[model samples]
Target: MPTHHIVSAFDEELKYLANRIAAMGGHAERMVDQAVFALVNSDHGLARQVVANDEFLDIGQREIDEKAIVIIARRQPMADDLREIIGAIRISGDLERVGDLGKNIAKRVVAVTEARQPVRLFRGIESLAELALTQLKDVLDTYASRSIDRIGFVRDRDDQIDAMYTSLFRELLTYMMEDPRNITACTHLLFCAKNIERIGDHATNIAETVYYIVTGAQMPAERPKEDKSHKVTAQATAAADPS
Candidate 1:
């Protein structure tokens, strides 16, 4: 016979943790979207707001972690209960990283606000950001609904973001090569693109965490990567000087 009172208290604690993580996920999604919008529109005010909002996500993650730890110590959960606690901890950490990446993109937007940037560059970045934000929103929805079946779908979509990023990287590099004046803005955009790509990765991490919580199994393996930035860079260097 399980202790009804203790189990009830533990259930409440777990629910609280889940709610906190969901809130953090929401903040992260908004921040990422706002940061990218600021970049595309050169809106420094929005970028600054995104930067400020990241502190809230940091606090949320800490609170979730503390609450999860207390639940573990008090309830001494086992099996499925233990998985739930650990999953919350892992998801919150991923959410925090997502916040940080969004913050990075926001910072870049601020840095490039005064610089002369090409509209095509902004277009490329906007496209990449759109895909990343979609993945983030889908994964968060999946987590909230506790729908494990959608985990693989979200996981598979990350590669699309990676491929988009790789394409943007090459396009930016070509712009820099064509005109040295474009280097400063292109460099900042490159960083912003990388940050957005990383946000997609964090979303994938959360998806895997959800999978673990549901199935009690580690994700099969690292998803096959489609990011070819390094290879493209190497090829560009070799073509520049064949000796």
Candidate 2:
């Protein structure tokens, strides 16, 4: 019947949209990995590649937005169908932000490479990157599979990434305080660490999107935050006080 054919076509469009989102997620993940690798290895070439690849992510986001709008206009989807299209748009936006964060890291990598830095500092950054990358990969997989059960696991991991970043911030501050020459390198590394932390945040946002797509309900509340960088800054200020 005509209705059956229309339903089939709508399903196909949804599938295509889902596939595009998955592809975007993969690119975002790879960019994060490469940006961190460049930072750890001082590979300016790899950093440049990450910066260049951001254009593709931008294009991907635009394409997804276009497709979502067209589908909504033509299909007039309701409830779950509407959720699916909306989720794609939201996820693509988050992935675009992920790309931008990776680009920020790449920019920092270029700066750090120009200045000499200690190897141990890189080790801390690399460890945080690994955890953040894992979160991103797992959340993308959850989105593709529509696995609501796995969403909680991905959401919980953001705190760990924040904790790691806070620790790195403190350590970098100490390094700068101990050696005047280390200020430039440590400042750049601090920014890179913050970018990685933000990527974890975007991954968490994607996880929430997955939950909404599956259940058609908002997440219960905001996830608990563990970032303590502000506290560390306050401690530093107190220590510097002459009074």
Candidate 3:
């Protein structure tokens, strides 16, 4: 099929937008990592730095959004070009939200540190965050390649992130119930867990955008029931474990 010049130009713009969004995703992921690092190590300076870097992420998101708008207005793209432009706009919005969520987590880190209190951030939350980051990267790769297979891969990983969230939440609830003194700290930790959960959701949203761009069909939320069952079982196990 011969490529139309308009499609070609739109492709260039969309590619630029994709690259920009991926850059934003990368930065947001780093921000989350730094925030957690700050929490685990009580590094208030690093938490502040993460919060500061979020401003740059905002600028990056705005630039991508403006470019997407320009492409839509000037190019008058249709079909796939249209999908690509719209997807860029939506994905960038999600990425911006991810940055905001990271900032929120960083703010919590500062509060926890200033109180001279320690929150036991276990392997479960760390594992979940890492899983979400992997899914974010996979979504970016699939967006760049427009590969349906890669999109599927991201979907599968999203399930894993969800499971991690379920386990983390259950464990935190146990801590709160065990000690009244743990209430305030556990609440903050819950918010942090929710922030990480939102990041996973945004990554899933980006994957859906890629799917729509490639197929022009909205991907249905099809999380497996088996996964949910397994997550429930694990939560029960965590509740029962005395260690």
Q: For each candidate in the order shown, give its overall lDDT on alpha carbons.
A: 0.83, 0.86, 0.75
Off by over 4 Å in 1: 1-6, 234-243
Write one digit per residue (lDDT tens) for candidate 2, span 156-206.
789899889888988988898888888898888888888889899998898
Q: Which candidate is the best by TM-score?
A: 2
lDDT of 1 by residue, 52-140 (tens): 99999999989988998888888788887888889989988998999999999888886677776768878988888889889988887
State the weakest 10-residue window (summed lDDT) of model 1: 234-243
Ranked by lDDT, the better of candidates 2 and 3 is 2
Worst 10 residues of 3 by lDDT: 225-234
Q: Candidate 2 clashing pairs? A: none
Per-candidate clash tally = 0, 0, 0
Estimate the overall C-alpha local distance difference test score of candidate 1. 0.83
List TM-score per model, in order. 0.92, 0.93, 0.83
lDDT of 3: 0.75
lDDT tens digits, residue span 160-240, model 3 = 776777778777777777777776766787778778877888888888888898889988778543223223333434433
Q: Stretches of candidate 3 above 4 Å error? A: 1-12, 114-120, 220-243
